[model samples]
Target: MKKMRERTRLIIQLAFAALTNGYVSGFLGQKLYKGKLKQFCLPGLNCYSCPGALGSCPIGALQAVAGDRSFSFSFYVMGCLVMLGALIGRLVCGFLCPFGLVQDLMYKIPVPKVLRKIPGDRYLRFLKYIILVLMVLVLPDRVTNIIGQGDPWFCKWICPSGTLLGGVPQVLSTPALQASLGFLFSWKMGILILVLALSSVNYRPFCKYLCPLGAIYGLCNPVSLYHLEVDKEKCTRCGACSRACGMGVDVPKAPNSPECIRCGKCASVCPHDALQFRFVHRKKEKHGQAENIEN
Candidate 1:
């Protein structure tokens, strides 16, 4: 069952990568056969300016609205985030996000060193919130007067993913754009290099400490219907689950911890089969079956 779940996760991840990078990013280059289904933008860090993107990115959209002097909807971006939080929660970080896949692939490259400890200072995790405010909200608004409205501040200045997928490609493909390179291009390239270097040693430095989208999704994990559950009656409490958890979550104790990305690593490593990933009634049924067997 564990192996099966791993295989399924691998398939999903591969499909996500293909869709985001291969299909969506490369869609325009192909024949204009059909358009994408209409949906409110997802609350993630995907680049809206990327050629293949079918929908607007939340960060890009947020910056655009925040920078705009004329109109800004309080509900659009927040509502989209709330909806996604209520649905899949932090599963987006583990399964669906293309950037998460990039980080995962980077960690697999047999690097010299990798982050083993989860860090003693829990307060450091709050840095993402500060970044969300400064980069996404405050900085954009402050710079709007100087830089002009409709600028995607985060995308243009800081996002490594945007630099990788949109800026670099667009510049390389269009010689005219390359000629327009200035200090902004150099700064973005520097940010991308820093992120790339950090990703080699850190498990998911971006998701853990930088992604505002992950911060939002993580807040809902404790209450989401789709969450991890631990059967305490069956649990041996050997701490294997916690040790195995890559996201620094105490999985057996706090199965639906906000820090959990729902990568299934804890459930996959549990020796007693005490940890499970079932909905409410499914958990009840399993517990009842165990009772019946024991009786």
Candidate 2:
């Protein structure tokens, strides 16, 4: 049953990745689609400038609107983000993101994996929020060139996904693009290489530490409709769920923590059937009852 569930997830991931970048002719002919559909944003971390990409990336679109001096804010982009976050939270990272799929595949490369946490791992996870706030939002909105134009700082300076899925393909397909490549491209390539290397050893180093989109979605995990619940009455605290968790969550303590991606790995591994995926309209009545009694 577990294997079947995992296979289904892989199929879904592959299908979504293909659908998002379905312009196969673009890869063959070295062209990009500049149609009306490009105006819309994809929910995942796909690059808008990817050769085969049919829609704009949400982060890229958000940065574009934020960086535009004429526009003070982007209600449409903000609304989309909030709605998606509230609806699915970081399940998008687990099941939908093309980059997350890539990282998951990399981790399966049969290498002697580093199965231990990095030093300061807990604190380092907060870096993505910092990146989202400063690089994605603040700098882009507040700082601009002399001409009142600001760049997508995250896309330009960071975002290995863009470099991998967009820049590399474009540069490979177009001879003219090769000569125009400069230090920025080299820097982005380096970052991509580092991320790819670390992903092979660690489980989702980029998702855990650097993905701004993940950071945004993670904030909504606790209150999102799709959530994980732990049944304390059934739980034996054997720690199987924690051992199965690649994200290092304390499953019994905080089943639906902000860092949780709602991947269902904990629920799958729980022998006692303590963990479950469910919609909780409010705090569990049992927890409230316990708190009242304790008080």
Per-residue lDDT of candidate 1, residues 133-194 (tens digit):
77777776666555466455667766887887667767777788889999999998998787
Report lDDT (CA) for all predictions. 0.70, 0.85
Runs in model 1 with CA error above 4 Å?
Answer: 1-4, 20-39, 118-121, 146-150, 281-295
Residue 199 shift from truth in candidate 2, angstroms: 0.5
Candidate 2, superposed: residue stretches over 4 Å from native: 280-295
Please report how far candidate 1 places residue 47 from its true position, in Å: 0.8
How well is each residue in 135-171 modelled by candidate 2, as lDDT tens digits?
Answer: 8888888889997767899999999999999999999
How does residue 47 of candidate 2 score in lDDT?
96
**Which candidate leads the pack in lDDT?**
2
What's the CA error at residue 226 for candidate 2, in Å?
A: 0.5
